[model samples]
Target: MTPAFSLAGISKRYPDFSLRDVSLTLPEGQVMGLVGVNGAG
Candidate 1:
């Protein structure tokens, strides 16, 4: 079955912080959470 939520080829860039080639998939009937602690600039 296809995913309920899909993310691909995600990236973020900054002089102090960066995130590259990030990917995630939340399948159907599943719960997911993204947490960032002190991960802010």
Candidate 2:
């Protein structure tokens, strides 16, 4: 099996928001959903 989507060693740094070592995977014939909200800055 292979991953349809993936992220490795991903990092983001900021004065307000930060994401580190984020990873994800979606197999074949699968659905993915991403939901998020951003506050006013």
Candidate 3:
């Protein structure tokens, strides 16, 4: 089966933090969420 959503080699940078080489996949009929603290971005 194919993925409904996909991410590869994703990266994010901030003055105080960073997200490097992040990857994710979501299949069909699925849900995803990113929960963090108030200051997280």
Candidate 4:
């Protein structure tokens, strides 16, 4: 089965931080979550 959602080559940048070449995929009937601290990002 194909993925419910897909992401590739994702990136984010800040004067003090950066996220590069990030990728993720969520298949059908699946769940995901992402959490971070108050200062994360």
TM-score of each: 0.70, 0.64, 0.77, 0.76
Residue-level lDDT for 4 in candidate 2? 79
Q: Residues 1-41, candidate 1: write the lDDT tens digits.
A: 89999889899999999989989998899996666687552
Clashing pairs in 1: none
Q: Write the per-residue lDDT of candidate 3 for residues 1-41, one digit (tens) a residue.
A: 79999999999999999999999999999987776797464
Model 4 accuracy (lDDT, Cα): 0.91
Least accurate 10 contiguous residues by lDDT in model 1: 32-41
Candidate-wise lDDT, in order: 0.86, 0.81, 0.91, 0.91
From the highest TM-score down, the ranking of the candidates is 3, 4, 1, 2
Model 2 weakest lDDT span, ten residues long: 32-41
- Tens digit per residue, CA lDDT, model 4, 1-41: 89999999999999999999999999999987776786453
Q: State residue 35's C-alpha deviation in candidate 1, in Å.
A: 2.3
Give model 4's TM-score versus the native structure.
0.76
Q: Which window of 10 residues has the lowest lDDT sum in candidate 3?
A: 32-41
Off by over 4 Å in 4: 38-41
Question: For this target, which candidate reaches the highest TM-score against the unseen true structure?
Answer: 3
Clashes of 3: 0
Displacement of the residue 6 alpha carbon in candidate 1, Å: 0.4
Candidate 3 vs 4: which has more TM-score:
3
